[model samples]
Target: MTATFFQRLGAVVILLWLAVGLAACSNFVKGGDNRHNIPLSGGVIQGLRNMGSSPGQGMVVRIFKEESVLEVWKATGAGAYRLFKTYEICAYSGDLGPKFKEGDRQSPEGFYTITPGLMNPRSNYYLAFNTGFPNKFDRVHGRTGSDLMVHGDCSSRGCYAMTDAGIAEIYALAREAFKGGNTSFQLQIFPFRMTTANLAKHATSPHLDFWKDIKEGYDYFEMTRTPPVWDVCEKQYIFNPAGSAPLNAAGPCPATVSNPALTAKLQADEADLANKAEAARVAAEKKAAEEAALKERGAAVNNFFSGIGSGIGGIFGGQGRPEAQTGTTTTLPTPSTQRP
Candidate 1:
């Protein structure tokens, strides 16, 4: 065979090989066995069943930024949620506040819902789901941002990032919840556990009012292990489990009654929180008073010593002066003897 003919054949063979390799890489990127496939661990499944929950049941997600914790709660057969798991966040971007605009790099803090459509199994980050930001409350306040996500890969730009293994289990749980006939699952993100102490500690923050607004929802959930039906009205979050009329995001809130027992409990809790805060404030004031008194005493002692030192120096200086010499005679000036 001619050398030129052999070269051309080799080039064709190389091109074919390249094409095959590209196709394989593409398939791998698209996921070989992991694409849209969520395999729950046997332990997880068994645990769920033991907790009176099944694979396909309603679920709720709660994230606390300060603690870097994500809690997954699943619905039991009794129509209440039980803590399924707590996953430590690998990373998250931004400080503790609501995301206001695009490119702010703020991971949002608020109530969000995730539907099946938000799932991105083919995510380059291993797995991900968008947190529906700019919801009713955000829109009412003219806040804007998009594609905020809880994703794997342990990196974040403006998202909550988890380890690949962590996200895999989270994704599986969420997917099963959807498959179990839930149209959506609630995801509540908070700066921290909305405890009375935390709120008081951050009482001077600019976001305090907003935090108080969200605390209502938090309190409701704590009182009853069920997700409160929440709606936005008058640019605020309104939660009512007693079935209120549909709310308009920009309109004023309508009057609604919450569960009476829960309401009472919440009121009592609030009163107790107020008492604790007041006690803390009083104690802090007392401490300040004591410290000020101590400082004042110290200053007085320092001033007294300083004055004594000055007086002693004056006495010694006077003793050392020519005027105070014990054995010296004074010379008087004579009358003028020369003409000026």
Candidate 2:
């Protein structure tokens, strides 16, 4: 009797909690935490130490929508950033596409710059940072949206949501980096892993062209392990442009200059990815063709057996063919016709 009572009470508690959470605007609505005051966990700090990095080093963030993951990278003594940690996204709104307007409920995918001012220690989600949506490229295209964020609460309102524990650690890292004098960090959000194979797989999607365009920046970071100094030109992302003159977002791009070694390496890598995609496409086509041929052979064999059965039926059933069958049968009276 006591156990049953306890079980009933437990169920009631869970129901009440879920009801309250679901009632909120985002479950991230209008609340806060003391978690931000805490420092990075010992485990995270040790991992940074393993990479010869400290908590206060420069940091960059990356988010992958399809994968539902976020990565935090830290600058190492080698002067290049290394992957520091990864967190699972608890929730995000909309499908895998860029946000176009306010209240679209779409999580954005693009480059954003986050400064200390963008960080929110008192966010309703516990900890949050603005994603700076509708960036230069978005503006050039006349896309509209605002207040996009990566935050804690395990729920989202067109935001990247992480568990409270996860965001606590992430927030601490950014705080320490700011104390170490880093002005701002880059946040790169992608539709997916941004591999050539993935692009090829999504070739039929309407967003392919846009993805290819952002891929230039993606390729650069993959090669250098550093966020490129990027800007908008011709309404697309351009990295490491040579001059300081402001670019016209809708105008032609200016000349770019980058490390020759890096350029060569990236070109070679791209070629390899392209080759792999092409090979996959060709293999898929070949498999489809083989399947079609197999299907055709099966059909022919079935038809052959069916025809034999029909012939046998006609001979045994006293009918020349299905169409020749009549309800009444006439006897063969050849003598009368011959005499006539």
Q: Model 1, which residues run further than 4 Å from truth?
A: 1-38, 241-245, 304-340
Which digits, one per residue and each the tens of the lDDT, describe model 1 over residues 1-340?
5999999999999999999998876675366656457589899999999999998999999999999999999999999899999999999999988899999999999898788988888788988999998788998899889889999999998999999999999999988888888999999999999987887776557997898788888888887899878898888888872455678788877766647876776677678667876787788899999999999999999999999999999888877776675567678988998899
Please give each candidate's TM-score.
0.76, 0.72
Q: Number of clashing pairs, model 2?
A: 0
Worst 10 residues of 2 by lDDT: 25-34
* Residue-level lDDT tens digits of model 2 in 92-205: 999877888888899998888899888877687888888988789899999988778899999898999999889988888999999888999999999998887787776657
